[model samples]
Target chain A: MAEEVILLDFWPSPFGMRARIALREKGVDFDLREEDLLGNKSPLLLETNPVHEKIPVLIHKGKAVCESLVIVQYIDETWGHECPLLPSDPYERSRARFWADYVDKIFPVGRAAWLSTGETQEAAKEEYIQGFKTLEGELGDKAYFGGERFGYVDVSLIPLYNSFYALEKLANCSVAEECPKLVQWAERCMQRESVAKSLPDPHKVYDFLLVLKKKLQPQ
Target chain B: MAEEVILLDFWPSPFGMRARIALREKGVDFDLREEDLLGNKSPLLLETNPVHEKIPVLIHKGKAVCESLVIVQYIDETWGHECPLLPSDPYERSRARFWADYVDKIFPVGRAAWLSTGETQEAAKEEYIQGFKTLEGELGDKAYFGGERFGYVDVSLIPLYNSFYALEKLANCSVAEECPKLVQWAERCMQRESVAKSLPDPHKVYDFLLVLKKKLQPQ
Candidate 1:
């Protein structure tokens, strides 16, 4: 079996970061191909993920696996018994998967809320707040979403949490204040060497959002 | 381990039906708790799925798993080596999961186009058309999304296909004409005994849409 793995990614994409973190955590060495979102994508990315033509396409042994969550699962399964992302227990694995799915569904919509204005933005904010609150409540007193250890759920959730401060600033609402437990959880996740090292700076995200808001606003 | 497994679901929800179909396919005979989405939700539903409070909660030996895709995976994992939803091959499993995730993300948004009116509806229609075209292009000449066998991807996609006629009728557009191959693929799926038995009447779905549209319309 060939061990050649290449990751096509952009720096700010949380989805791409997930694959990077997973690879790093597993102590697997792979080639990282940085993509320019503004310019034409690499031939490798296009060929690898013909359907979506999106980033975070993990080419393992020349086979492309698209979608961050799906790629994460593939990595876990392929590298099973070597720093497992998923739990060995069937029920526990299901629970971990459930949280990852929830994060995938809600995070994009929540992030979009910060980019819009007026009624649409207001509605998005309400939904976003509700989602964060639910996450906070679910966390309760757990050290991580996967109970004590930092597993798949924590990896999935923590990436999105990287944008919370920036999103709060852009929306003019404090997600941290509203969902304290989730905020605390985010902070706790940052303490992990894997998370701390993998995540990009929060201020750069804020700057990016400011530019995005300017570009999106009516002249 | 108990032989009994219960599914909390609503008939109209494609998500719920995914669980029902998976259960039936697995030959797992259990209790079906039909939830009334418009009226009062059961305490069990709330207790079981505290985060989402959504249907398609599969309770096995008192533990509940939410999210349709997650539940499907759970069912497959729990069941002994019989009709497996996921392929044993890691690469094949990744492909199956990719298409399933694609369908899960796009189907509802496409359905929303049918349920809207005026400019909002037009925007949704454009989005739906693009998604449909992509889906069709992806299918090419494959018998199922997972090639020959009607595996997890086929099961995930068929429910959305069942609603296509209803959606086209509601939106006053011919999806079949626009994406002939996809329509044919869907019809092929319907020919299967498992799918034919599991799905509701297509006309009934259109009738249900009329009621939904009326309720959703501004007074």
Candidate 2:
């Protein structure tokens, strides 16, 4: 019997989407449990991730893995021979990990800026633009962050690109126009069956953000 | 002949210390090249880590690995069988990675609070206390973050403990008194030869911070 794998996630969470894309790409059989971020969380989610209380927990054979990148790496390590997210060479793997860590560090800051309101929002926007531009400079001419391959770094970053449309609408600035190569890379990723199936429409994500903003506002 | 591993680093940087500690623990013979944070950095440092010209950069066999955690992982992957920073099991590795990622996320917020000077500093201190309390709660009775063995998570977090004394002094509160388990764990980590040799003295770290504060202050 195939070992049971369960993912606790929200459909719109990029972190959750990372695991879904990896599973889909690898053709792994798993069960998905949708989580409502606003409502009372399931005991499983709370018990599995006592520290963070966030979604996107991957349970494989009863062991839980939290953090999207960590879970993705776990998937790669366990099923590395099937569909390799990382490279065979240790050095290449290190570089892939480096870029993935960079994405992890900056993504939150950018997301905060993209989703923020008022002065704090404006400050976050500035930080986001700076981070995006820096990333663009680093990317320069590569087909993917890993260069010519949609490897671990690409897997870590591509899902977040789905939010660019929402950020563009909210921040009133087009990331595509500013960083053409990133947009091109994102477009390429969107064409993949895994990405296409795993992510919701950009407009839907934007609408979700709007609901979030309204709910967060002081009454 | 072993390939020359050149480390681009700044003293008193916990991130840089992560790499240093890993290298020392692995007993990997490497050349250390210090980078001036306030002055001009070497062309090698900038060229090696073009995206974020921040230290520390580990140049092994002419390939550069930036980001402290990534470099530490690389060191472990390359040489850990000799002194195993990460566990052999895939599940355990994933758990270690998750805690390391959690530390990465929360460390900055804690540091920000620890370094603040006035009324703003109070809020940052509260944030740090809250973060530490949560960590203590999660840690429970574990000897190390990676369970009984002192592995990758310990290496990743131990150096950051150097900042605690300065933080306590700055915040006018004792994290050691508040979170006794965490403090004891950190103290136990200091007993390791590699950790003790590599870590800077707490008083010296505070002195360095004082110098940094003066340099950063408005004239």
Candidate 3:
């Protein structure tokens, strides 16, 4: 049976990009169904992910897979003939999951850093930077978090590079200055067709956030 | 080469119980080193889990795997000849992970419900109960979360069943009344030797919490 793959996503979401990149990695052809998350959420989106009611839902062969990391793992497993996202060894797989989990946490902290103010924003910024620094420490002297394999952790994190431009403008912070290695690693990732194609323009993301910020907190 | 396994844990911790249960499920005997998480932490504990510096570190052949869910997955992968905790199918695995992730989140809300006061406690209790009710809906006539197999989601949550007595006393609430199916599921899990032996007496947990609470918030 021919597989019918579809991704219910918002273009700006880093989480969505992770699934897109993973699908690309597996050479899977998928339809991207953009959802209006803020204004009017689609019933399909709600129906697929009833729990979170959130996106990056990968509908493959009629089964809906929610959660970006889980979706990536699913994509890897389903079409695992080539370009494996997670390592074959159990220990390596665990290590990949651990780092991906760490990357998962950064989203909230990074969002808080940008969206909040006063001590809350400052503290979030500090913690977010600390998280990146820790990732840097793990990433020490290796091409990727998987050490020569551009795999799970790399797919988990590279999407955030799209948000970096928006974050720098909004938060007045610089990951490039703090974690140059991460930037270098991301640039290296961009060289790949999968990553290069998946990520949207950061400036567009920044503009959208600007509109969102005004709608969220008016003057 | 003979396999050397050890578990670094704290008795009252549900997270620690997960690792112990997974090991027991795998039928792999290991030395259990109880960590003094409150007092002086062992150097072994610190060294083994330098990143989190937290317990439920499963050391197999001298390499440490931290995080209870990750540790469970590791145990499942390593000693997977019998009593497989996670399903083989990728979609089923993803579903197990999604539910387990939901269970992981209930810990903080449940903790807040028990530890905090007034409005904060009320809100946490509400959210925690809601989470359990959702689990009940998902369980809906199933023999287990995995539908007759006590798998990853089961292992992830059965540890929390140990905390029910402590939680009921501390929060003045009842899982039995709110989530009857969930309570029944817990009882079913309790019948498993892996779960029965791994969890400490809840009354002991309650006493430990009282002492720790006094230390944390003194009069």
Candidate 4:
């Protein structure tokens, strides 16, 4: 039986990018249904993800998988014959899940650095930098967060690096300066066809954020 | 070599109870080191989980696993010879992860209902009930959130039910009244020795909440 996979997603969403990168890496042929998140979400998106009404919702053979990392794991497990995203060992898999979970935990702090204003923005930026340094410590001299290959934690995080330029512009911070090793890692991830093709241009993301910031902060 | 397992936890914590329940369900021998969250956290806890500095850390053979749900999954995988917490099927595992993630997402909303006051409390209570109803809809007559046997989602949520009595007192609501089916499911979970023995007394939890509420509200 043939498998049918569809992703309901918004472009420029790091969460959505994780699923895209995972699918691309697995060499899976899937349809992309771009969503209008700022406007009315598609009925398909709403019906598929009634609980959160959020993307990227991965519909596989009519079953909806919500949450980006969960969808990535689903894709990896389902198409595991081609490429394995997570480590096979239980301990290593747990470590992969741990780092991915850490990325989830710190996302709001990173986003707040760009989205917020004044003292809140200042505090968020400091915390975000600290978070990056912590991740740097984890990365160390390793080529990838997954160690040898571009795997789960890499897929989980590399997507966010797409918006780093935008985030830096808004927050007046330098991720490259704060965590040079992580910046090098991001550059390495960009060399991958899966990650490069999945991510939007950094300058375009920065331009989008300029408009978004006006809407978010107001004059 | 025998597995050296230790759980660093605080009583009355639903998150901590999850690890206890999972460990018990797996029939794994372990030590419990209670933390004084109100006072000083143990140096061991500090060194082990420096990132979050939170409890319910499962130290297996000297390696620490933080985050309650992640620890539960680790226990299930490490001791997978019996009592599999997560489903083996990729699709079902994805669904379990989705629901468990949903529970994690709504926890702050549920916690805030009890922690806040006046209009904020009212709003949080309303949101919390809505979230519970959403979960109830998902349960839909299943014996556990995992459908047949008590499994991942069940392990994820049953711990929270331990404080239902306390939450009810603080927010002036009844899970039995609002979510009758889910309340029944909670009762079924309580019959399990794993869940039954791990949870603290309901009245004791409520009394603890009274003290906590005074500290939180500070009239």
Candidate 5:
């Protein structure tokens, strides 16, 4: 029997892009239902993820999978015969998951850069730049975080490309200038059909961020 | 040849306790090297986990795996021969990982409850209590989160039992009174040798917390 796969997602969400990219990479056909995150959440979204009530819930064969990384791992495991996302070796898999998790852990630094101002903004930007250096060190001339393969860490992080321009403008720092290799790496990722299709226009994302910052800061 | 396993950990840490429980559950013989986190971090700990330098690093045959949850997952995948921590089915595995991630997510609320003071503390306590209630709802009369087996979610969460008394006193709430079922489930987990041996005495943890709070927030 063919699998029924449905994704509950918001367009601007990096997390949703992860699921989309993974599904596309795995060659899985899924029904994408755009969510009204700013307005009322759908009954399906609410029911599917009663705990988080967040987007990027992948419903496969009637069971809901929440958390983008977990869902991405699920997609990989289920359709691993085609394009394997995680490495087969246990140690390599642990490293992949580790760096992917690092992406999540460092997000607050970037977030605070945009959402805050003055001393707080300066501190966040400095922290984010330091975090970027560490990430760059990790990248270290590898074509991809997966080291020559567009796999787990690539899928986990490339979504953040959508917010790069907006963050650069708001945070008053150029990621391209700060981490040239990372920017190059992101461009390499964007060239892929899966990532190209999964990501929205960077300009559109910037516009959305402008509205969001005004709404959130209102100053 | 037998695999050499060494754990870089702190005796009081819930995170460290998680790694210990997983190792115990797998019946893997490992040398436990306790770190003086308050003092100087050992050279091995520094070398093994240069990224986080945090406790609960599982060093298996010279490869270091940092992050408690990641280490636990590694242990499960590496020695999945007996007492599987994560389920075999992809969906079940995703759910297990999701709930474990959720446990890590809600932890900041509990930490805030103990760390902060005044209005912030009150807010954190309220948030922590609300989060606990949600966890209790998830528990829903199950013998364990894995339903009759003390598995991933069990290993992920049971370590928090170490801080229950300290959290209760500092936050001005009773977990036993707030979520009776959760407390009961914790008690059930405590009966197991893995848990009993892993956790420190509750009063001792509370005393440690007193010292920690004074050090962190001196008046």
Candidate 6:
């Protein structure tokens, strides 16, 4: 039986981008049905991810897999083995999972940096810099997070590159200056066709975020 | 060499209970170093999990595994596959992961129900009921979340059995009434030695939560 693989995706979500990159890296032929996230979410998305009712859901073989990292793991597990996203060793796989989780959990820092003002924004940028520096320490002369391979952590963190632009413009900070190796790593990741194609343009994302900020604040 | 397995655990944490349960389920003899999480976290816990500075950290043969579900997966993978926590099939494994993710992500709903008061608490309790009813729907008539197997989702959620008492007391509600099957599932899970021995007393947890609430609110 032919596999029916579909992704209920949204273009600007960094979480959504991870799924896109992972699927592309595995060379999976998938239909990306872009979601109308702001105004109206599709019924299929609501049905597939009834728990979260969020995007980047992987519907494969009539089963819905929600959560971007979970979707990435699902894609990695169910699809092409030639390019494995996660490590085969148990400990190494755990490490990959940890770093991906770190990326998932660290979003509020980045959001505060991009969306807030004055003292709160300043503190968040400092924390964001520290967060990236920690990632830099983890990267630490390795070609990628799992050492030389483009694996799970790379797929997880690379999607944040577009967000870096927003932080740079809005927060008036440079991740390049703050965490040199992480920026270098992002550059390396961007060279990959999968990452390059999956991520949205930074300017567009920034504009949308500005509009979102106004909507959120309602001033 | 004998496996040097040590858990950096805290008594009040459902997250910590997950690692404890998973390790016991694998029958891996190990040390449980209870952390003074509210006061001074051990330097080893600090060193092992520098980013989160949290428990439970499952240090297996010098490698530190943070995050509860990830630690559970590590234990399931590294030790005995005799009673596999996750399913063998990638699709089923994804489903297991999805439901486990569901449990991990639903902590805030449960927290709000326990911690807040009046309208906010009432709303959170409603949300909590809806969330568990969703779980009950997914659980169906299955002996566990993954059919008859006491698997990943079961392990992920069963630790929360202790928290049920806190909600019942503080929130003035009953999950046993709203989510009867889920409560029954919790009872079923408690029958296992892994779950029974690992989970703390519900009353103790409730007391700690009350103390925590006072500390948090400064009232």
How do the residues B122-152 of candidate 4 rate in per-residue lDDT, one tens digit apiece? 8988887888899999999788887788999
Query: DockQ scores for all the models shown?
Result: 0.77, 0.75, 0.82, 0.82, 0.88, 0.79
TM-score of each: 0.92, 0.91, 0.97, 0.97, 0.97, 0.96
Off by over 4 Å in 6: none
- Give me the displacement of residue B162 in model 3, in angstroms: 1.3
List model 4 lDDT by residue over A7-120, tens digit each: 998888899999999999999888999998878999999899999899999988888899999999898888966568898887788888989999998899988989888999
Tens-place lDDT per residue, model 5, A24-133, is 99889999999999889999999999999999999998889999999999999898566799988889999999999998987877888899999999998888777777
Q: Give each model's whole-structure lDDT.
A: 0.82, 0.82, 0.88, 0.89, 0.89, 0.88
Worst ten in a row by lDDT for model 3 chain A: A80-89
Worst 10 residues of 4 chain A by lDDT: A1-10
TM-score of chain A of 3: 0.96
Q: Is the docking of candidate 6 incorrect, acceptable, medium or high quality?
A: medium
- The model with the greater lDDT, 1 or 4, is 4
Evaluate model 4: give its TM-score. Answer: 0.97
State the lDDT of candidate 1 residue by residue for A73-167, as single tens digits.
Answer: 88888874657889988899998998788887788677678877889888888887887787777788999887887789888888888887788
Considering the two chains of model 2, state its CAPRI-style docking category: medium
lDDT of 4 at A199: 97
Per model, how many backbone clashes are there? 0, 1, 0, 0, 0, 0
User: lDDT tens digits, residues B104-135, model 3?
Assistant: 87888988888889999999989988988989
Query: CA shift at B200, candidate 1, in angstroms?
Result: 0.9
How would you encode candidate 1's per-residue C-alpha lDDT over B1-219 as one tens digit per residue?
565698998777788778877887777787989998778999999999988899989999889999988888888888845778889988889988998888877886777788777898888877777777887887889987777766787778778876777777788656677888988888888887767767888888788777877887757
Give the worst 10-residue stretch by lDDT in candidate 6 chain A: A166-175
| Candidate 3 clashing pairs, residues 3+ apart or interchain | none
Better of 1 and 5 by TM-score: 5
